[model samples]
Target: MSVRKQQLLKQHRRNKRIALLAIIMGLLLLGFIAPLWLLPLAVLLVWVVHEAWFADHLFYSPQDDYQYRFPDGVQPLSLRLVNGRLQLQESSLAQQATVIAKVQINSSWLGRWFDPSICIGNDQQTFERGAHGVRYLNLTGQVEALTTAGLAVQGRFCSIATQIQLYVFTQPSPTAGNMMILAPHADDAELAAFGLYSGANNVSIVTLTQGEVEAEYYQRLGLSQQHAAQLKGRLRAWDSMAIPLWGGVAQTHCVQLGYYCMQLPKMAKQPDVPFASQQSAEADIRTARRHNTIQLPGDATGLPTWQNLLADLAACLMHFKPDVLVMPHPEIDPHADHIATT
Candidate 1:
């Protein structure tokens, strides 16, 4: 299980204990104390019990508001804004980034039973920050939309200190990804699917149906079924979204390169872009260096030959001394070379 899930479970158990205590105390007071005091005590007990019994649901419910935090020095981030705009102060970020919170509400029968904190409401925000340092997310947006339903999400995170532009806006046509409406929707299967599309505007993202996912895989990674379902569903709903997530792209590669440099024994100075290259392979290498902080070969981690395919990476880092570095998550299945690089 993920550290987040474990923490959440711990918190849940604590809340449950608190609720049980409050109830017991309230009952005792009712039997032996004044009506006014006892009545207030009873009410408090009820509220606490409600929170404890339904903490998970209360958490994941759309109405609940939350903020994710990173301790000092954490890096990388996975952010989600459902019904709110995220305001980030680039300067306040520390070197490392960690997910301080994962809040949401799931209104499924099994969810409510297996995890009683399930409730029905219209707001949801999840945080998946990577790295091991602290960063800040300024939730300085309006809360009016958050109080309502029908998904509105905006997610962004730094891959290698350079933030890629990923915005999801709302439109009439369901702009971004393909939208899948759930038919005969059950509580466990209410959400269909949506795809992430390259629309004319930013908000062109899609929604997906739940049945079309391998939930267990993500669940094993400590993500809630709902969260994993949505991500996979979104991919299925969108065209070429899988490419960015799977294949290596220059921009994405650079992002990873920036992240890797930050961890080396010594960092490099940022590279200078001489000119744009027409060849993608050459261009990818060049662009990777251009935005990089460490100048060629200097920022790389391992020795040249030992690194093999990573020779270019080492060279890129050495040429461009970036403060941070990032690389794609090495694929563990079906591809040996990719896994080796990852």
Candidate 2:
């Protein structure tokens, strides 16, 4: 935030690749000109450059486990929801049992609302909202009498369940430790885990974007290009807010880096000349400024300059101080922002 820091940031942006390349080239030139006393130092300098910039780190530790696999002997369900209840792999339309979990209810019938109940044979458990994919709403009525016949599940309305797997609640796993999730785009975290973070005792979600996401559906609605882009970014920002609610995460725990994607290199090293012209696909500054909720840099106004996104991201890490981080695989993923998000 300081003026001096800002000036340094600009200088860093301007020389991201040039400084390293220049040093290496100079060292190589020196070695070629004189192969005696200065030659050894130049070769060492070149190796140092390679080691710092290109080579992989020598020290290593075992990677932490992020995904949770079901233990042996646990049955996972692929059920169909019809009328009011989940058919429990029934796959038929004959039954209309009770549905209690709030996630699958469709919630619209001319403003008619149904407070669905879960049947515990002798008594009924009443609930509203909550009970998403990973986070189960704990109810008192059905705590005791669970049997193979399965308690009846009823919903106010009907919705669909694509996949459902049940895991026994025990002490928290490694994932429950202090954790942080890094998302390159808006919904990437939810695409990976619906409510997994709800189980973690201490966790935070950090979404990185230049607000460059596209919402072509908005364009179809006849909005101008900039308007559509801003709307799309705000919609994703809304998504960031809603996800934490689903996982029982406090609203403050989620943060967005309102930093734009860096501009593409106008100058190349080995080539070092203006390359052939290409299409222009850039980060939407309009969209980034519109994104609400929690953002660290630029208040909410994002930029699209030629700077690395890491400085802002590093500030986020320092603030949260989480032990475990979930991020996109740099090599496996091909998106530039996705690669930088880690």
lDDT of 2 by residue, 44-163 (tens): 876785655434212211111123444565444344334433333342311222222323323234112343334434455443322222223232233233222444454333232434
lDDT of 1 at 160: 18
TM-score for all models, in order of appearance: 0.23, 0.41
Error of 2 at 103 (Å): 37
lDDT, model 2: 0.50
**Residue-by-residue lDDT tens digits, candidate 1, 60-153:** 3222344443344444434454234333334333323221323233233332333222111233332322211222332223222222331233
lDDT of each: 0.32, 0.50
Q: Which stretches of candidate 1 lie over 4 Å from their true place?
A: 36-45, 48-342
